[model samples]
Target: MGRGTAAGTVCFAVANQKGGVAKTTSSISLGVALSDLGYRVLLVDLDPQACMTFSLGLDPDQLERSVHDVLVGDAEAAEVVSATEDGPDLLPATIDLASAEALLLTRTGREYALRNALEDLLEQQAAAGTPYDFVILDCPPSLGVLTINGLTAAAEVIVPLQCETLSHRGVGQLLETIADVRKMTNRGLQVRGILPTMFDARTTHSRDVLDDVAMRYELPVLEPPIARSIRFAEAPAAGRSILRTARRTRGAQAYADHAKSLAGEREAAS
Candidate 1:
């Protein structure tokens, strides 16, 4: 992969195992923000509820195929992927994905199911000479089979953390889970960093919680905490990311900066 080149696809899982942390929002925003910088991006919605799908103006109920189909071996990933007006491609999700956990449990080598599927997808894309530059996995709010598949498939994991005491509750559990994944499935897996979301600089408590979290894990804290914004909640209703809906807002700028940092990291790694 060349420095800042779009040739190599970088897979990152945005996970927290805790709902309301802006996991889906971060995935979508970051994907689009990267696309804005001219990278071909793909966002995978691993949540059965399909918030990411619905956020992009795609109706999960009307979809004939989704990530669920791809995971269960019923459809190719290319068949389910759809282009979004926001510029990134999406492998959407639906309620059918709720059955994936039970289905994967019975199969041998189940943890590698997504890894195998994604590898085939990437190979097919590369053969055609139109590979994606970034693949962002939006994990559900639980560390189950689906989340494990993401952890297994990704080269790095970005944890979207809420700046609250209760929000930090799952950090330890997720780290322990990642430790297990590295030993058993993905040895190269690394935590990209913790992204503080839904932040409020007005309150000292938020700042304190952020400090406490950094000390707890000694993990890199991705900068420019996404400020608490109703614009985020409004964007989904408009079928767009904050980058599109509130382009001039601090939230949008934060995501754009985060994307730039990610690109710089890729170039440095290269």
Candidate 2:
């Protein structure tokens, strides 16, 4: 494969079965930030809400094809993948994706649906010789069939954890679910790292949560948690990454640094 079709790509699904954790934002920003460092990336929106798609400036309602269609065998993955100006390419989603869980029930080997759909994309990359350095799949905040597909396809997992007691409580259970997925589906899957988000350094509670989480997780916590930023909240409205819409903002720098550091870690590991 020579790092093309067989050497294997870093398919990290940014997942956490919890909402409001910056999972989608981290997925989108990390894709672009990594792309900025000269790596080809593909961000797959597995969430039926399609927040990642809409955030990147695409109208999920108007799309002719979505990740759901690809999962249900209605269309090819290449048909729905669109280019982004910065670095990552997007395989958008629409609300119709919600039906995918029921729609694919009758299909054989249903859990492997997304992995199957990625075949053409992988082959194309192999032939073009521009193999993607990373493919970030943004999973919904649930352990449903859609997330199952992502678990089946990915080589690693990147979880965005909110620095709050309630959110932190879910991590142990989430890791157990990952273990479940590994036992039956993706043994290759590993937790690349846990990224702490929305942290306030001034607050004792936030700092305590950060330390608690780091002490608990086996994987090293990526340094520099993403600070609470309204600019990050606003970037999606402008249909761009924080790196573009809020380039000079601290939120943008934090995410950018996170991505760069992740790449460096992977390089060193290899």
Candidate 3:
């Protein structure tokens, strides 16, 4: 309903238990779009696969520090933050993050680990007068400890749904996990909306799935669904978001408009 913290930063976790729903794409696109609008933004890569990290043009293997280090308490989040060419600062991840799950499981209050880390980062940034306006977390495609941490740290969750049959099968399960997170960890966590990605406007099946999701879940479907595009795939190779690489494309324009709408909502809410 409101921003996550009193510090005025709105943290969004783009998550879905099912993969290939454009979670990473949405995270990068949204963050970059917001940054382009002059908002200070941070994008955190919580996926062990480091797709976001690689997509932002960073070599996870070459990095000496990652979100794994921050989670393990070996490094502060500020120390791991790297400025990306995509306009937003990044908290990169590596394969080592996969082990963080077992490590965090053995630790007490593991669900709040990400929240604590981000809060500390936000405080430090605020003190420097460069506070971020938004934080976008690209959660791993699972309901594991990592995703739990991401959910716990975020104020809102954006479910990126592919408008295809069976693609939304996991939305129900994810809602259950969000409910559990609210009951146990972060009560302020809210579902922002379902974002349709890779949408085929020409297909009635796509429209059918969107309608069914809205009717069944009673959740709002964000407007101007991101149309399916090969350009989305190509942008990552250049280590940039579609907004930067394919500025004139419909998919890019959709994300830009989505970011504006979300930002405008936050402003209106405030």
C-alpha lDDT values of all predictions: 0.90, 0.84, 0.92
Question: Candidate 3 regions off by >4 Å?
Answer: 1-4
The best candidate by lDDT is: 3
Query: How far does residue 157 in candidate 3 sit from its true spot (Å)?
Result: 0.4
RMSD of 1: 2.1
The all-Cα superposition gives candidate 2 an RMSD in Å to the true structure of 2.1
Cα RMSDs, all models:
2.1, 2.1, 1.3
Task: List, residue by residue over 1-270, the lDDT tens digit for candidate 3.
Answer: 128456689999999989889999999999999999999999999999999999999999999989998998899999999999879999999999999999998999999888899999989987898888999999998999999999999989999999998776989999999999999998888898999999999889999999999889889999999999999999888988999989999999999999999789778866
Residue 91 error for model 2, in Å? 0.3
lDDT of 2 by residue, 1-270 (tens): 112236356677888999889889999988999998988889999999999999999999999899988998888888888997666999999999999999988888898999888867787877887767788899999988988888788877888888888667778888888999899977767887778898787789987877778787765677778888889888888889888888777767888898888688667655
| Per-prediction TM-score | 0.96, 0.93, 0.98
Of 1 and 3, the candidate ranking higher by TM-score:
3
TM-score of 2: 0.93
